[model samples]
Target: MSPKLDRIGSVHLTMRQVARATQNFSPSMKLGEGGFGTVYKAQLQDGQMVAIKRASKENFDSLRSEFRSEIELLAKIEHRNLVKLLGYVDKGNERLIITEYVPNGTLREHLDGIHGNYLDFSQRLEISIDIAHGLTYLHSYAGNARFCSAFGKCSNGEAMDLVDPQMREDVDEKIFKKMLNLSFQCAAPTRADRPEMQAVGEQLWAIRMKYLQLGREE
Candidate 1:
């Protein structure tokens, strides 16, 4: 059974428990590796699957400080779109953080067409809105604001040319235009040209409603 993650809080996890869950840190169970550590797929004794990042001990002080920073930030966040911290293990040379497992892989993987198929327009729009909302929450409440954009060619009215050819038929060109147009508007070179945050939200809502209607039609 899947772990009831929503009800769980960050708890103490023993090295043995994590080691066992990760099948002795088997390479086959590894999901990915990043700056913090190698992430392995772990199944707890309670049948909950989670990602365990085993911090590298090579540079103890540096990695340990980063590990603590990560834990501090993730522990305070409780958003559906963000990964939730389940537990941590910090003892001796072992330092680890276990988070809720997300099996779908990264957005870059999907965008690169590594996943089965390219995402359609509606899916892309929904994803954009979800990311915006998540970032908005982080900026407003998490005390760490970070954002980026790539809207030069997009706002040039060539957004349709950027659509993945594989899923071109699945995409609604008009909606794609609206999405990219709003992206450019939000990222207007001059602050005066940019719409207010509230207006951006309202525009996204209208686009979302249109996407729903399009989905129902097809």
Candidate 2:
């Protein structure tokens, strides 16, 4: 159960009312909705556009859990590629998490699209590396013990939310090699086989540095 918000003076809002009261709304503002909730593009008072995720009241426990997880996790870490969690609201069944808007779109789009401007091999490698590094930090980056059980898992292989599988095929050989290795390390059948996120980040960094040197020489 979500802990009640002591403030807000018990503002009871229907789904429709809540939608209208949001910072902004339009067809273009719509990012995407998942099983949990719909995401909207809202411009803050400071004129910063943010993606606000509005969680549905149904599946109360699941939504509450996700809200709690996102808040707790995003609070500690900060990175370029990693999505930023701006803030959250929980008052009388109205739960929402405000996050930074990523205009570049998902890595998936760059991976598969007619847009002449796609993430080059290096960019693709960097994005994947960045994601791996972020996950690594999340897994081992200790936070308040109150939120123990650090149960975040990498959902990479599963159907990607942002891109298609066909695009993944055209990735350069070297990029594929590194990604395969990282995925394998993360999903090692034996828990012991999985390397810590910190270790993985260090390894990826080392590999990237070496690759850069090779390019410089050639």
Candidate 3:
């Protein structure tokens, strides 16, 4: 284990303990499954709920490396919006990462899935601001941060298209546009061209405040 990993306050769980907590990876306990592996909702003996990610065996070496990288990266960073790594289990070919359970589900699910209409316009704007803050922290403090414009185009229509349909009608166009502009600036073609994360966070906060003010007026 690297010194960084050792320094992390996370507890290391044995494979048997993880299996028992997850009921031997029961399908009913599964929270989600992705390219990395399946995540299960587990309850520890101490009554703490956690999410455990178990790596698939297909690409053992590659997955192991990714697991180690994730541990190292997560250990160095701490943010309210980011998931907290609780621990990991590495026994033979099995690799599992344990993290704090997020009860409300993922942002993607809220924006595009069955929970689409659940969040109000103000809530959505606040979420956007929170994401920007998280990104800012990563860019400003995390050495491995990279700019990835995965959100979409910054054009008025294109940006609006990316917003959850339920939020579109109630969203403040002016604030939305400003948020898009900040996103565009952060995603500038070159690293040097991109605005610093602190600037992005400030801009996003300002947009959020404008949104809140508009809500009060209406």
Give the TM-score of each candidate.
0.55, 0.51, 0.57
**Cα-lDDT of candidate 1:** 0.75
Tens-digit lDDT track for model 3 on 62-93? 87656666576666678998787777776688
Better of 1 and 2 by TM-score: 1
lDDT of 2: 0.60
List the candidate 1 regions with Cα displacement exceeding 4 Å.
1-11, 65-70, 144-218
Clash totals, every prediction: 0, 1, 0
Question: If ranked by lDDT, best first, what sequence of candidates would result?
Answer: 1, 3, 2
- Across 25-110, the per-residue lDDT of candidate 1 in tens digits comes to 99999988788778999988878788988877675677666665555656767788877787777677877878889989878888
The local distance difference test score of each candidate is 0.75, 0.60, 0.75
Instruction: Flag clash pairs in model 1.
Output: none
| 1 or 2, greater by lDDT | 1
User: For model 3, which pairs clash?
Assistant: none
lDDT, candidate 3, equals 0.75
